[model samples]
Target: MVSSTAQPPATKRLAGRTALVTGGSRGIGRAIAERLGREGARVGVHFGGDATAAKDTATAIEAAGGTAFTVQARLGKAGDAEGLWSAFDAQADGLDILVNNAGVNGGQVRPAEVTPEAFDHLFAVNTKAPFFITQQGLSRLRDGGRIINVSSGLTRGGAAPDLLAYAMTKGAIDVFTMTLAKELGARAITVNAVAPGVVDTDMNADWLRASAEAQAGVSAASPLGRVGVPDDIAGVAAFLASEDSRWVTGQWIDATGGALF
Candidate 1:
């Protein structure tokens, strides 16, 4: 149901748009931040760790003649999400795009083995934070603005037994995006999700380091020979943020390089 012809001029398409990308210090989030900045939008990079990485991302944006700032926040903590908005808003003023890209795989624990604390924390970051964060961003996001929730292809592709909890969280992301898009549709704010396959991010790189077998297994199982890269997801994210996808909403686009198929 996306109207591809609804595109606007590139120069003014996302100009003046301010975006907040959570867990944006590295990986897919970093790619999204850089891409949006290149498109003439003010960028807010949110990080849970590696302050240096966050600063580096912000610096890269500035170096490219774009405005940007960084904020550190732990989505696992209660009230931390509210604080994140305060800092992000102070830096960028208002938001036009919000990318919920901060997530984890529950540290390779199976759902049956996951403790209450572990499972709760995963949902807090992957599902809870985006829900409340987007709620907070509503006042700031302009009508016809964008929201891109980062999910995982594992929900449909089936996760390794150890990744069940992580897949569960991503499932919530899809439902959250669909329901919220309907709720916000009246205002023209388009809500959608992008589910990525195994991407060559710092996150996956760590997992690859921990278990090369697992990494090799994923690559071999994929329809594409290799894993995905950050730019792969970033390009799709940029389209969601731009006027090119103004009429798109309430759905999840799989950016898994056909891994699920």
Candidate 2:
């Protein structure tokens, strides 16, 4: 006897998984966090500051029928990675997915104008933080888990000269991704990088929306005739975090909507 009111079950690919997304309070990080939450992962939304934003992100996840918590820690400082993990430890016993998405653009400093201070800051947040974070997180991350790094399309050719320092940091991330994937292969932990091109996030809204010309220029850059949204990158991150990406490792996925091509 089939019931007339019977409903189809919801899909929760990440059910029972625990994930931590750095900078998850906003931008692409928030998108990834929300998507993972929808997939049924108990997500730890990490933020540097802006407790309010972090709370909002957590609320959004919970509102969507997912479990979420907030973790606050300022990265790029001494012992920052350890402190971040400590905060996460207080809430969750282990981690199944780690997304290193926190980073800074280091302004628009060209190679000639780049200073030692700016370079250090850029590398600290974009490179060193992720490296040490991963080092400390390995203890908490369970085997067969996932590690997804948010890289930039600027690391590829045709990048603007003004983005030299910023791109260098992401370049290091690419190397880190390949090397770490090899090292972690024994544990069945897949490591990959998701490279996005000119995503329309709050960070880029200032310039990207400055004028119709600006907007059109960006849209035209992609063969798809559109600018990328945070969800565009999130979808790729979600795939990398899921069991479906088990065989995909050590690859730098281009999420640029064919802009590079």
lDDT per model vs. reference? 0.83, 0.91
TM-score of 1: 0.90
lDDT score, candidate 1: 0.83
- Tens digits of lDDT, candidate 1, 1-261: 111123222353567888889988898899889888878888899998789999999999888777788988888789877889888767766778899998877677766789999989988888898888888879888888899999889888888898888899999998998999999999899999999887876766666647767667767756766667788888899999988898899889989888777
- Give TM-scores for every candidate, taking all chains together and pairing residue i with residue i: 0.90, 0.95
Candidate closest to the true structure, highest TM-score: 2
**Strongest candidate by lDDT:** 2
Overlapping backbone residue pairs in candidate 1 total 0
Clash pairs (backbone) in predicted model 1: none
